[model samples]
Target chain A: MKYLRLVLRSFLRSKRRTVLTILSITVSVALIAILQSILATLNAFANNPDASNRIVVRHKVSITNLLPTRYADWLRQQPEVESVMGLQWFQGVYIDRSNFFPNFASEAEFVNTVFKEEIVEYSDAQFREFLRDRNGALVGKNLADKYGWKLGDVVSLKSELFPITVRLTIRCIFRSKRPADELALHFNYKLLEEGVSYMKGRVGTFFVRVHRADDVPKLIERIDRHFHDAVEPTYSETENAFQLEFLKMMGNYSAIIQMITGAVLVAILIVTANTMAMAIRERTTEISVLRAIGFRTSQILAMLMGEGILLSVLGGAGGLAIAWLLAGAVRGYVGTFLPYLQNFHIDAGTMSLCFHATLAVGTLSTFIPAYRAARRPIVDGLRSL
Target chain B: MSGEPIIRLRGLAKSYYRESLEIPVLQGIDLEIPAGGYYALMGPSGSGKTTLLNLIAGIDRPTGGELEVCGHTLNGLDDDELAAWRSTYVGFIFQNYNLVPVLTAFENVELPLLLTPMSRRARREKVEEALAHVGLTEWMEHYPRQLSGGQEQRVAVARAIVGDPELLVADEPTGALDHKNAEEIMALMEGLNRDLGKTIVMVTHDPKAAHHARHQIHLEKGVLDRTIEVNR
Candidate 1:
């Protein structure tokens, strides 16, 4: 502890160099922290704790392939299935492509039952009004606020994939338990069925709530087997697995992101090592003087290592703070493109990972240079200057 | 005090090797200084005066012969052991004063004592006493940069004696000082030797500085040339 001041003073011997080195580390650590946070958020989506009792049934051919709407009746007949809702994705643009949000058409009755977890608050009269009007719609609080929408406001969207435009009056605005769940709009599926001839008897997917979580695997196999010979075969899996399949559509980019993170850390290590090497080389004579004054080699090495670790940790901590602050802004930006990132944040787990990474970088960068400097003969070091 | 020599060198030798070239710096040197003796080593450049002083201080090892100081055989001691020996028995003063620039006078003077098992309060007391002896007690909080060259050297002197080591080895302690500061440092060193009973071994090229010692030994080309007794 007494040597801490000496180590710090020596580190600040070149104030500009130290500050610059710390900034470099801060930038890299921030980048790394953000990347790791994104991966964690994606993983959380894939393994959502709330989705354990739910399963999704889609066409076996592909997600783009549609399944018969009557399949929900067959799923509900199974003892394992408790409730079922038919969901069809409607790819429509509001004013521009940049103002994107998830818009889906699902059964209006199931909105207040099967998806009770998502709706934090909504009055019974507002939902009855939605059912009473054929062109009525329900919007999430986040989506409504983004467009300054309120009850009775008419929301219109032009379909890019279809030859029709949707105009509906907003009758319900609901808050969600999760931030990401609040960036969506759901309208009655009957509107799409009555308007479009192609979607009259089909739905994009079927969301089923199972009676028990432990029976999910067996129920998935049973449902898939029952429709094996059907004209439009069905595929069944847990809701978490279905979300993971969507995530997997981007391919196995997790490995690529990890590789990029590794490359960034290596670059940071080199920069830090070079800075530390130069700092130690310039102090050769001073180190020799310390040796002459009864400082042993271990003491000298410890001092240098201490200084290096301090610099790296400071930079890392600063970077983490920056990452934490930028999380919400980045999520808002990404929410425009990927709706699931609306809840982006640096969780406690990622913070711990980054803290450990900072210490590791510190140790790796300084060990070789500090050891070399400490091991040099005292006479040679004294004569260096 | 015992009449036996505190420092003894028997046929001491040191050499440097650059690839295949061998350069001898000191050869066939035999020397002894009794307890509380004040001696100055005088020679030309490359005459091995500093090299011999380093050998006696246990900072450097003899190449071919036995060397002993403060009753410890230095030839077989490893680097760590030598460092421990120096901490216990020897104190060093360099021409550059060599106080750490970042540390204040009190901290610099307290450095050698850090090697011991002394408590912080004990170390502080020792540092204050040493600084008082050097008449720099009031300047304890000043850094080396804030002090004059003479004051810096005095702080260095305080650092050297703070641990109360048995021998003081100074390599041209006043070489970088002005004439007035040099005389003042010599007077202070003379008082340390005469009053505190410290065995002093100094290496210098200035005759004025060498005259302050009780005896002067001259070397030429890595060999002893002559010894003179000073009367003052």
Candidate 2:
């Protein structure tokens, strides 16, 4: 305990160097925390297709292929599949063409029943009126924000695949907690079909609400088996598995993150080692003094190592704090592409490893210098002064 | 008058070899120092007075002889053991007053006491007594930098005596001091030898400093001449 006091004094003696080293480590750990947090959050959010008992039933053929307009009605008639809704991508862009949002078509009547508590209603009357009006659409709050679309605003969209111009009056605005969902523009399929007659009776996907989550896998397999030899083969999977497949296409991103973290850790170790060695070298006489005063060689070693640990922990905490705060500013820069930015948390186990690693580096760098200082023939050390 | 000789050296020899040339620092010397006796060694440079002092202090090994201090053979002890023994049985006051620069006079004195199992209160009490013995009671809390040469040397003396060791070794203890502080330190050493019965062996070339000891020995070319006893 007393030896620790002497070690701690060295850190206090040079506050500037200590703080700088701390900032270095903080940056590394913070980057590590932020990267790992976003991936984990995204992975979890995308995988969670079932809030309770939900299943997405896309085309019996390719999801790229359109489903029959009659499927939603057939799905609603089934005892297993409770209440169905169709969601088709509209592929629309804002007037400025710079802002991006999700553009899709779904039944305005059953949207609340299929995905309740997701899209906030703009007004009960306006919402009902939009579902009844053939040329009406509901814009998400984020989309409305992008184009300044008021309740009575009219929006014209240029379709990509259909190659047609579609216009509709904004009847209501929907709000969503999920930022991804908030930036969407939704309209009824009837308006989409009537506007483009060549695409009549064709729907994009069916959202099947099941009573139990356990029934999803079987329902997906059953849905697949029903159209096994269709013109376009169908692929069905759980939401997480579906997202995981796409994440796999990211090709070793997690591995890359780990590599970056490894490099950062090594860099920190080197910095700490050099600083510790320099400090020990400068205090050669002090070590000798401790030895002369009846301290054993081991005590001197402990003192040097203790000093290293303090420097590292100080550096580590400082670096971690700075990294955390820096990540906050980065949120405004990274924007919605990296959500859960505030989820950055310091993991004690990792920090403990850093602490122990620092201690090891301290011990390693000081070994030669401390031993040299301690083992000096006492008369020589005394003779020096 | 009270006990056996606290230190005995028999044919103690130390040699340095520079790649095949054996240079003997101390040759075939036999000596005994009893408790309470004050002995001073005087010699020119290369006389091995410092080397001889180092051997007696257990800081170096005898190349050919047996050295026993307070009933323990020096040859049987390791460096760590010797340090432990030195803290308990021997106190050193170097010529330049080798008090740690970072420590105050009190902390310097408190250093040797750290090795002992004494509580802080006991250590403080003994440090106070040792400093008071050297007449630096008021200067205990002052750092070495703040103290004069004489005062620093006095603090070194207090440090040496703090553990109440069996023997004291002074290696030109006042070499760096002015006449006033040097004589003041010499007087303290004399009192320590005469009154407290500390068996001090001091190495010096100054006759005035050498005059304070009851026994004066001369060493030349690693050999000790016949001793001359001085009146205390």
Best by lDDT: 1
DockQ of each: 0.60, 0.33
Candidate 1's C-alpha runs over 4 A off are B20-22
Per-model lDDT: 0.89, 0.73
Clashing pairs in 2: A22-A315, A26-A319, A26-A320
**lDDT per residue (tens digit) for residues A1-385 in model 1:** 7788789888898899999999999998899899988888888888888789898999999988999898988888999877899998888789888889988888888876667778778888998898788888988898999899989999887777666778989999888888888888888899889888899889989989877899999999999999999999989888999999889988886887798789988988998899899999988888887888788889999999998899889999999999998898878898668976887899999889888888898899999989998888777776687
Clashing pairs in 1: none
Candidate 2 vs. true structure, TM-score = 0.76
Number of backbone collisions per candidate, in order?
0, 3
Structural similarity to truth (TM-score) of each candidate = 0.94, 0.76
- All candidates: TM-score of chain A: 0.97, 0.78
For model 2, what fraction of the real interface contacts is kept? 0.23
